[model samples]
Target: MTKKNANTQALHALGQSLWVDNITRQMLDDGTLQRYIDELAITGLTSNPTIFEHAIGKSTAYDAQIAELSRAGKSGEALFFELAITDLRRAADLFKPIHAATEGVDGWASLEASPLLVDDAEGTIAAAAQLHRAAARDNIYIKIPGTAAGVKAIEASIFAGVPVNVTLLFSREQYLAAAEAYLRGIERRIAAGLDPKVESVASLFVSRWDVAVKDKLPKDRAKEKGNRLGIAIAQRCYRAYRELLAAPRWQKLAAAGAHPQRLLWASTGTKDPDAPDTLYVQALAAPDTVDTLPDKTLEAFADHGSVGAVMAPDGGDAEAVIAEHGALGIDDTALAAQLQQEGGDSFKKSWEALLKGIADKAERAGNAASKAGLA
Candidate 1:
């Protein structure tokens, strides 16, 4: 037989979970998502405002449902989330098997809280719980930004037994902050004699770092530049992740039936045309971690990607790479903060656009319903 999903299967065999960072009703209804799960070993899916905005705005797959919900008087953020929960619930059901098989380690779908709530700790906590309950699936994670307020929300959500995917973290310190929030939540649950098994993941964006610094590097050093910053940051984060799991704090939680909050690699798609399509996927391959890639990146990897040496637990050359960039006037800390803020703002813009698109679509849908004597 020909090599089918050869590279994806190879990566899966190497102990890393590959999740597609996109979702749509068409993919689920047409079985494309299922095929990815069965053939390409895609164990999970993730969604953000940007992804949902495109999936709903760019296609008619959601038209009928939008019309139905519009008739039922749902619009704005409520309408957007109604559509999102529908799609994610379907995806979560598809991944239910892997979720059960791995005992909640591998298969999971993520739905982000509204980007507007990034700075509202109390609102974020309420939103996460409500969304998780709205999704009503064990495999669904309510995504919260890993901002300071979001850290508070993360802890509160987890303590309330809602799974979370902490997004927008760009540095090792940021990742640690998210992880600490998760630990505190679990620790509280343990203290309260709760289940203490709330699942979570800290998402560290990668490609954006390289994209931010690519033009800053010297022209002659262009070829050696794109992959350095992102990979270095990821390596450092990965090292901390490994160390955190090995620490006594985590061991106590483990003994009390807690699971490690996985370190997720987000924004793995190569932003540079000159870079390898599988660059981040190949470089960040490590066990006990998750890599959420865009559909194109996943397809490119499935078609021709290869899994090479796994990332070293000791964070090989991460310090050196950061030092090199520091010498070049690139403050990794400052850049990390900038990237996190920019990511939040970009998603907010997308969320607003998506809501507008939904309003417009709902109006058109209502017009058609009136014309057809169905109003």
Candidate 2:
């Protein structure tokens, strides 16, 4: 590996698992995903409807399978999951050695449950369990949003032994709620004599916090506070994560052989053009956490990113920074709710587009197969 790639390895050495936030069948086929693991220390990955929309809509890498599945009488959500699970299973196998080496602490891939189920706790629960079983891979997580309904589903899913990646969280409170769900599930499992080691991660989205408030900052201090909200929020959440791990409740779980649900930093890519490309990656480095970087952010960091001081376990200056933002009329609590709702809405859009894209591709593939007398 070049010195540039070693920079990324150094961050991994600091105890945070580097996970790529995007996946494409092209990457898997062309060896790009494996290259990331071998050279840049990426141990895991996470995917969303937006990523899948772009991947399938823009590339022909999945064309053959789409055509075959189309001919086999599959379409819509069923067809989509078939495609997604195939890619996730391949990625999971690639990470299997790391999964074994780390004893399941690292080396995992995530597939999000249907965004349409964001408001249906029962539906989300069933979909998460179904997806996990369909993937049939021990190292894969079925992502469930951390919305209120999703929180309910999360507890049930965890109890059902479905590994979960809690997504779309935007604040400490949201993170705590998700963490509580995980705890409750594990506690129930231990009570029922089941293994307490069901794996999980609560993903707090960092950069979107800044993006939502960038224009709302006071004009005089915009330069000082422009991109600070996200990091401050992450610091606050990191402190909560550290505290939870040390709490008596979690201690009991640990004693019962349960693994603490790791806190994951998601949406870490910088959105402001004026900010450093590696802004989130550099600032959110913390031990026992996962940072899922977008492709551009991962490549930028691997090429030139430097790991600054890891996040303070006590959340140094986080409250003060948040207080300053509050003085500017930015209510972090309300904004967190808004962001979560907006994220769900956004994912719903992507999910619709992804299904439509798949349907359109399948149609064209079927038509072509018909013309060729192969259907």
Candidate 1, overall lDDT?
Answer: 0.92
Give the alpha-carbon lDDT of every model. Answer: 0.92, 0.94
Consecutive 10-residue window with the lowest summed lDDT within model 1: 1-10
Candidate 1 per-residue lDDT, tens place, 1-375, comes to: 334587898888888899999998889989889888888889998999999999999999999889999999998999989999889989999999899999988789999999999999999989888888788899999999999999999999999999999999999999999999999999999889899888898999999998899888888876766578999999999999999999999999999888899999999999988888999999999998899989899999988889889999999999999998898889999999999999999999999999999999999999998999999
Each prediction's TM-score versus the true structure: 0.98, 0.98
Worst 10 residues of 2 by lDDT: 1-10
Off by over 4 Å in 2: 1-4
Candidate 1 residue 292 Cα shift, in angstroms, is 0.9
